[model samples]
Target: MIELAQDSGIWTATINRPEKANALTDKMLTELAEIAEEAGQPGGARLLILTGAGKVFSAGADLDAMQGGLATSPVWERLSSAIAALPCLSIAALNGTVAGGAMGMALACDFRVAVAGADVFYPVMKRGFLPQPSDPARLAALIGPARSRLILLVGQRLDAATALDWGLYDRIAQPGALMDAVRDLAADVLAATPQHVAAIKRLIP
Candidate 1:
């Protein structure tokens, strides 16, 4: 499930199923894509902040739904692409662990802020599945080809500090302070004109 809120030009989307480690379902992914589409429409929020409700950011796709094969679903691609194409700046507030396809979702954001002890990994290979088509390029764009290889090929599980150092996360906050850090960044972004921010976001790779 997902919850979306808007206040003073900032839009926040929270993944609400903490009991399942916020593992994504088809409906949740669809909602994310829909929210992303709405964010680009007229009079939409100026900034978008994506976060998870509890200690796990997302465990990625739900295994039960993958019985037919993961390739049958296009929601992940749609959601990530929609997020990247938004006119306004977007941030992924990584409150906790991020793994598998969730890494692709986080990489789609313009910036990311993770809690100090959060961990990141991409285990597609280990699971005998290839990475999503958009994932490798996006990951490479954020952390460079070498590091991306280590993550995608070597199956490295990076801690928050290493991820920050590799440019995967723009900032790190202490536990229980992730939202505070996000709000501070949101405030700084709000100081700029929406048009200016949108223009700058478009120029980023």
Candidate 2:
């Protein structure tokens, strides 16, 4: 359900279940938590990029896996918190359509750079679902409550341009260049000292 590729201080995690719009299963979320924990260790990584393979980034919770009523399991809260607590710099390269819990994953990152024309939104309300607490809070902090509601509650599918305009994403690259763009952004971020990065991140917000 995922792939990990590392180079020097940069690590990339890719959601691999493209056949299901990369929908995350309970197992997948568990694996993601593990990855986040592993990557958070000092010297293990300076930057971590979260991405998805194939056409759709991730459609959110895998209905198939939740069919037996695993939807209410505590695993979701654990996974969300793990992603939020990860210590290293995290970036989300939204290369395709992103929705539902998958949107929460993207929001967990410190920076989000998506591909232009990509469909990026959280449609939890449309599915009769609610985002975990961390999701809405983080989204509101990143893009403000008004825009957050527009996306989360209203089920607005935001294209890259709209996302950038609302500050939902830091930048919008051409489709198919998401990773390259992320790599460049990572390089820029890595140019700074870790102490400085952490200090600024903490002091400013």
Candidate 3:
């Protein structure tokens, strides 16, 4: 499930299925894509924060959904692209481990910050599937090709420290401070005009 909240210029999207580690069903994924698309529209929020409830950011595609063709669905690509193309700043405030396809959206964000115990891994190889098309280049851009291969090819799970060291996460916050950390990261963008934020982001890539 997805829960969206708006305050001032900040928009937060929380994956609310904590009992299931926030595993994404096709409907959930599609909803997320729609939300991202909405954020990119005129007069949308200037800061979009992607996070989750409970202890995991997301366990990736729900098993049944994956079997139902969720793994190969274009929704994944669409969601990430929408986020990446936003005129505002996007941050993945990782609450916990991000596994499998969930890594795609997180990587697509302009910034990623995680709690101390968070972990990052994409099990594409182990699952006998390929990642979303833009995901690999995004991953490599953040952490480099060799480290990207270790996760995508060797299935290594990088803990918060290692992920930060390797450039997957930009900052590590303690559990209770996750939102505080996100607000801190978003402060500047939230204060800036939408045109200013979009101008800076466009200059990046």
Best by TM-score: 3
Can you write out model 3's per-residue Cα lDDT over 46-115, one digit (the tens) per residue?
8899999999999999998999899999999999999999899999999999999999899989999999
* lDDT digits (tens) for residues 71-124 of candidate 1: 347888898898888888789999899988887779888889999878999887
Per-candidate TM-scores read 0.95, 0.91, 0.98
lDDT against the true structure, each candidate: 0.87, 0.79, 0.92
Better of 1 and 3 by TM-score: 3
Candidate 2 or 3, higher lDDT? 3
lDDT of 1: 0.87
Best of the candidates, lDDT: 3
- Give the lowest summed-lDDT range of ten residues in model 1: 64-73
Between 2 and 3, whose TM-score is larger? Answer: 3
Ranking by lDDT: 3, 1, 2
Q: Taking the tens digit of each residue's C-alpha lDDT, what string does model 2 give over 1-205? A: 8898898778888999988889888888888878888887666667888888987778888887767554565666776676666656789888787777777778878888887756787777776766776788888998899988888788888887888888888988875677788878877668887666666656555
Positional deviation of residue 22's Cα in model 1 after best superposition, in angstroms: 0.6
RMSD to true structure for each model, in Å = 1.3, 1.8, 0.7
Clashing pairs in 2: none
